[model samples]
Target: MTREYKRNGNVNLFACFQPLAGWRHMELTLSRTKIDFAKQMKNLVDIYFRSADVILWIVDNLNIHNPAAMG
Candidate 1:
């Protein structure tokens, strides 16, 4: 049997993609908690679409991806 390596910490990359615009924004965090995800999303939106009337974002089915996190 092979030995298993366990890690206590992990890095997460939060990214937003705009296919039509050919652009993306990314943020790295040590944890993928709700607060961290929300902060990353807010930063990206504030930097890229602050002046826009509406912005649409798509994301995978992550545990932290929910309305509570966004709020």
Candidate 2:
């Protein structure tokens, strides 16, 4: 008897929400890494909220969400 297995990759969903503006954004990636968190923050600041005077972030306590990741 022969057995074979196949694997399908998974994804991580990174999201942001602005309750005042009722705006939300989501990013999907194959992996969850510090670099990916930084990129998500970059996109939120550079593309999504560039016009805003102040941008506040609330994130989970995941290791990848460390402030050092932004550097």
Candidate 3:
């Protein structure tokens, strides 16, 4: 799962992933005063796609591109 937060006018991005066959889970969060494309990609790597042996992820990164406080 992926989520975004806006606190004190700063944009924050977070991603979480879990392995189906194992108890291993990963989570990443990045906070920026503005949009950060590199941080977003890094979150994907550090959180969801950290393992080289893993091949697929079931979650989506849809809301990453949206504004911080959108409906």
Candidate 4:
């Protein structure tokens, strides 16, 4: 048990699903910074979810996932 805990070579996965239509989307990135999250959101809305009149988004209580991040 001499092995120490290490945190290298990890990646973040972002995904969403629509059960009604059995549709889903996912992306992977090295990190989950504000800029990366903002880009992911823009892609989701402007491209993937463009057909919807409005996007009722929800997320965990992550500090980065705020209105300020979107700006």
lDDT of 1 by residue, 1-71 (tens): 89999998789988778889898777788888999988877877687788889887788999998999987
Worst 10 residues of 1 by lDDT: 40-49
TM-score of 4: 0.83
The best candidate in terms of lDDT: 2
For candidate 4, lDDT tens digit of each residue in 1-71? 59898887888788877778898888999997888889988998889999989877777777779999999
- Model 3 residue 16 lDDT score: 42
Q: Ranking under lDDT, best-scoring first?
A: 2, 4, 1, 3
Off by over 4 Å in 4: 1-3
Residue 62 Cα positional deviation in candidate 3, in Å, after optimal superposition: 2.4
For model 3, how does the per-residue alpha-carbon lDDT over 1-71 read when each residue is reduced to its tens digit?
98988666544444444556564533344454224544544556776577766545453455444445222
lDDT score for residue 29 of model 1: 85
Q: Which ten residues in a row have the lowest lDDT in candidate 3?
A: 25-34
Candidate 3: the clashing residue pairs are: none
True-vs-predicted CA distance for residue 64, candidate 1, Å: 1.0
The C-alpha RMSD of each candidate to the native structure, in angstroms, is 2.0, 3.8, 10.5, 1.5
The per-residue C-alpha lDDT of model 3 at residue 14 equals: 46
